[model samples]
Target chain A: MLKIEGLRVELPGFALQDIHLEIANGDYFVLVGPSASGKTVLLETIAGMHRVSTGHIWLDQRDITGLEPERRQLGMVYQDCALFPHLSVAENIAFGLKVRGRPPSDIARQQERLVRLLDIGPLLARRTTRLSGGERQKVALARALMTDPEVLLLDEPLGALDPQTRENVREEIIKLHTELGLTIIHVTHDFEEAVAMGQNIAVIGAGAIRQVGPADEIFRHPDSEFVARFTMAVNVFPGRTEVGPAGTSTFVVADARLLTRSTVEGPCWAAIRPDSIQLVATSSEAGPDNRFTGQISRIINKGSVVEVTVDLPPAMTCLLTRHGFDQLDLAVGRPVCLVVPPAAVHLFQD
Target chain B: MSKHPGSQLRGKSRGGGQSLNWVFTLLGMLILLFILVPLFKMVFLSNKQALGQALLDPQTLSSIGLTIYAALIATAIGFVLGVPLAYLFARREFPGKGILEGLIDLPIVVPHSAAGIALLFVFGSNFLVGRGFKAVGIQFIDSLAGIVIAMLFVSVPILITSAKESFRKVDVRLEKVARTLGASPWQAFARVTFPLAWRSILAGSLMMWARGMSEFGAVIILAYHPTVAPILVYQRFETYGLAQAIPVAAIMIMISALVFIGVQTLLRRRDAGA
Candidate 1:
């Protein structure tokens, strides 16, 4: 297990304030944030490159905050695949082990195991300069894993590869995760990578983590407007609480209002993923549900889905599959109805 | 149809621009020949019979041997000290890095005689550094040791700048990765930076060595007693005119050229090892 309590670091544009996180022994944690949001700094700090201004990092119940990188037994793979150009692939994989004073006999066996496991057996004798991008990234990964580090940190591990290569590398990482069950902290600005790799996701912004939970929970229920906007929740608006039957709820701006899902009664903001919104043709629809009348302002093609930006009474935008859009024959100025259930509304303190 | 417009223009411009390339090429070759022909002439016109006698002469062989030995010593001194300084200059960005870099390049830009004079002042009997070293029973004036120091003064910049350029060409990310991979700072540098930049560093050392071997003005100014090869050549020229001096000059040229080519080939092999 790895835990950081009240982590703080001062950076040029941002300051990490009272940040906290926990990762189980085998959990794959993803730290997602915008560029220059101190994401890399935070990783480097945990890696022992940056000294924390305040806080303690506990690994497996031992405080290793003051330990150097080598002593901390933490492995890091950079975005650029920092392989030593002078060393052969085999030597690079054996570097950490040899540095730790491991016997040469033991190192040879370990190196062979890692080389075969990473599928870099053919590249063992080859110099690092000859490896492809994916090949280099694998070698870097294998090198880091050879040390048997307590936690493996990946900084945009697949950010440099082409689209097709990224998919293959992503699968390789997933396999590594399943086999090793290593505590992993992967950082990237990419949302899809977060969904694919992270069991737990921390939505970070500026410096502080705005929200943290299971990947599905954080996406289905963000804690702030920043996260909602970052996660492509395009239907956020200024809201207020009003008493209703049984209890109270929040309302979004349009000529119409939205139903609140939570019971906490205060002025709060709400976010809903684009896919949560359901759209239908306006045909005197009289259903016992949340609905809003609108005219389709535009139909934006987004690969497999068509995002319909509408000028409703509430001025809403919702995402629908291409099949749905084609069935509805969505066009500009076409009248439509939007339905958002209470369960889809995510509310946070204003 | 565009029927090779470029080819047509090429034909039209043949009389004017075509001759321009030929003219420049001839000028460049003339510059090359003008520089090299005299060197070739020195060897061709050398009296091998007299040179045989001169080679047997104690004074002549001693001077040539002194030149070769002094260059070896100067190269050793620079290799020991200049390389680390160059590496630091290339990698670090301290407050005074620019000033230090300028100081290293100053010797390369200054004339050899001026450098000899500067060294004389600093390592002279009365100056602080000179006095301090003299107190330790070391001296740098009119001695074989002085010749080595003077040669080093003129050629140290070549080694520093070349080694620094090689170090700078190596990516810093490689070093950072080594750190994360559990190698301490020294281990990281020895295993990575030094090896990768080894070829360029060797090339630079050879350049400085050759520069030191050919140095004349500095040796004359600082240490005229222990005559080096160039000083002997100068002495023969002044006394017996060009005939006697030409053979010694030819000998110096042949030896330095062979060493330069050998070093270049060795460096190429080192690069291939990478």
Candidate 2:
């Protein structure tokens, strides 16, 4: 288990304040945030590169806050794959073992294991400067894991690859995690990647973690406006909530009102995912509950799904499957009615 | 189509370009000749029989040997002290770092004779450092140690500046990665940083060694006895005139050029193999 309590690090023009986190052994956790959000700093601090201004870090019930990186027994792979250019791929992988003064036979055994596991057997004799981006990433991963560190910290590991290569490396990481039962902490700014690979995630913004929960919980229900916006929740509005008839909740934004099933009262913010709003023809006999009439302002084909922008009192974006869009024959400037179920709306107290 | 616009422009511009190219070629040849003419004249003017006799002379051989040996020792000393200081300056940022870097290059700009005079005051027989060394049974004046000290004082800045450039080219992230992968700070530097920067450091050592071999002003002031090749050449010129001095100078020049070319070729071949 790894635990960080009240960790604070101060760098130039950036600071991480009072960060608290806990990860169980063998869990795949991701730290997600926007650019320059201090994600990389936090990872480096955990790897013992940066000293904490305040707080303690505990690894496996031992306080390792003061240990050097070598003594901490943690491995880190940088975003740029900082491999030693002068060494061949085999030498690069064998570096850690050689530095630790392991016997030659033991070093060779571990090197062979990693080379086979990462499928880099053919690249062992090649120089590091000649490897492609994806090849370098594999070599870096092999080098990091050769030491059998307790926790492997990866900083944007797949952020530099093309789309097809990204998918391949992502699957490779997941396979390695399960096969080796390794505890991994991956950091990235892409939410889809987090949802795909992480069992639990911590959403960081402006140098602070706003929420930490399971992947589905973080995606479906965010705790703040900032978290909602960062997670691609398109329709978020600040409103005041009042108890309504039939045990429902009424949220009022400037001239618009939305009904929700949430029992929270007083001023609040409400958010709904773009895919949750359904669009129907204006003449459809939909119920009056949570229904609004609007004109379609724009329609965009987004490969797998079509995005339709509706101009209600406040503009809203809705996502539809290509088949659904073709069935409706949607076009710009067409009149439409939006159906938002009460259960789909999430309300958070301001 | 009959008169292509691109073809016409190329034809008109080609004539003007040829004259401009000729002017640059003439200027380049002038600079080249200026360097080569003196060397050719010296080699051709010296009588071959006299040059061979000078090469076989005992005094001449010992003087040339002492000069090369002292310069080699100076280069070794420079490498031992300058490499670590260069690495430190490249990796750390502290108050007055820029001023300290400028101070390292000061010896290069100072006049060599004036530099020898400054060293005389500090390491002369009567000075504190000189007395301290004398207590340990080592003398500097009129000794090989004095010649080496003079050469090192003037030539070490080249090594430091060149090593610093090589260290700067190495990425700090590579060292960090090594540290995280179970290597200590020293291990990372020895295995990664030093190997990556070795070529530049070797080139710098060559420059310092060559510069030390050619030093005359400082070595002459510090240690005039146990004459080096340059001092012997000066003495011959004064006593026997240009005829004797010409042959000795030509022999010295040939030896230095041969050594320089041989070492450079070995380094280039090693680089290609690596």
Candidate 3:
């Protein structure tokens, strides 16, 4: 496990205020945020690139904060796949293992396993400059894993790949992570990538993480408006909260009302995942369980899904599937009910 | 207007006629003529008899031989020392990097005669360095070694500059990767960076050697007795007039140009093969 504490950085206006996190062995932890959110900076710091102003990093219980990147037994893959162009693919793949002073036979054994795992056997003898993006990324991953590092830090390893190639290489990275059971702290601005790739996602903002939880939970239960917006939580409705059951609160959306399971209220904000909202026609609008009424504002065709933006009362939008939109067959000016099940409602303190 | 697409495209480049292009072609010819005229005069005027007579004279032949030998020695010394300095300038950052690089380049801006006067102050037989060296049986004043030192003093900056540019073009990631691959810093540099920059270094060395060979003022002031080819050419003109000087100048230019073209061709062929 790797742990970081008090990762405070004094930037011009913001500080990375006391960042504390832990990654257990075999954990695929991802740092997700938009550009300039300090995700890359934090990852690079963890990778032994930048000097932490005030912090201690522990790798498997050893204080490695002062160790050089090469000595830390940590492997890093950059977005650009910084492969040594002067070396052949075989030599590149064997780089870290050689650095560890392994015997020739032992190096060969590790090289063979990586070659098969990444399926780069034939391309091993070729110069690195000739490798395509996917091919180069594969070699870079293999090289990183050759040392059998305690943890692998990937800085948007697929940032340079095409869509299809990104999917393939991402799968390769995950498969290696599974096979080696390596600890990972990957960073990316790609929302779907984070969801698909990481088990535990930290929603970072400005320079600090607003919330850290299981990817699905953070998506369903964001703790702040910043986290809400960053996680692609599309429907943010400003509202006022009133005290209710035990610690629970009732939120008053504009021209509409909804109740969350938690209550800390003055001026409160509520977010609903687009997929969390169920669209129903006027006949089914008679239910009273957290419902809003509005017209089908627009229909946007998202591949295999249609994004339905509804100007419902209380004013909100949600993403429903093409099949869901097709069967509803509701046109503009057509009235419908927006249903956000209370369990799916994420509440944030004002 | 005819709607032929290709013809309209051609018309835009040439205004549908060749008049403007002809002017451009003539302008290019004039530019070439401006450069080639001086080069043409420098060659083709030297004759075998005059050159033979110059080479036969002991003073003239000895000076030409010493000039060639000293330039070679100085170029060799620069190759050994300048390459590392070039690499350091290109790769490493330190305090006073700009000033150090500028100081290395100072010789290029200083006049050759001024360079001779400066060297005389430091390495003269009566000066501290020259006196110390003389005590050790090594003398700088009026010696072939002094001429070689003067040549190196003046021309090494060019070698360092060209070599630094070459080393900069080489991706530093290659060195980093080599280090991660278990090669030591020296091994990585020797195995990779040196080979890649070798061509540029070679080209730079040739240019420096050519420059050093043509040096007159500094060598003449420091060690005029062991006259180099340029000084010999000068001495011949003083005693026997331009008739003697022109042939030696032509012969020196011929030999230097041949060497320059040969090395350049080799560089081009290697690049093309790669």
lDDT for each candidate structure: 0.84, 0.89, 0.81
Query: Model 2: what TM-score for its first chain?
Result: 0.97
- What are the per-model DockQ values? 0.52, 0.74, 0.28
User: Could you list the iRMS of every candidate?
Assistant: 1.4, 0.7, 3.7
**Ranked candidates, highest TM-score first:** 2, 1, 3
Quote the positional error of residue A112 for candidate 2 in Å.
3.2
Worst 10 residues of 3 chain B by lDDT: B174-183
* Candidate rank order under lDDT: 2, 1, 3
Candidate 2 docking quality: incorrect, acceptable, medium or high: medium
Question: For model 3, how does the per-residue alpha-carbon lDDT over A270-327 read when each residue is reduced to its tens digit?
Answer: 8888888888886465344777778888877888888777775655677767777778
Residue by residue across B1-274, what tens digits does model 3's lDDT show?
Answer: 7789888788786774587778889999999999777666757645667667866877667767888899999999999999899999999879999999989999888999899989999889888998998898878778977998899999999899989998998877566544434456776687668877878888899988998999887888799876788887788789988887887787788778887897788679646634
Question: Candidate 1's residue-wise lDDT over A276-327, tens digit each?
Answer: 8888886646343667777888878998998898786556789888888888
TM-score of candidate 1's A chain against the true A chain: 0.94
Q: What are the root-mean-square deviations of the candidates from the true structure over C-alphas? A: 3.9, 3.5, 4.3
Off by over 4 Å in 1: A8-19, A239-241, A245-248, A254-256, A263-268, A282-290, A313-315, B1-60, B254-273
- The residue-level lDDT of candidate 3 at A203 comes to 78
Measured against the true structure, the TM-scores of the candidates, in listed sequence, are 0.87, 0.88, 0.82
Looking at every candidate separately, what fraction of the true A–B Cα contacts under 8 Å does it contain? 0.57, 0.89, 0.21
* lDDT tens readout by residue for model 1, B130-197: 89989999888988778989989899899999899989988876776677778788877888899888
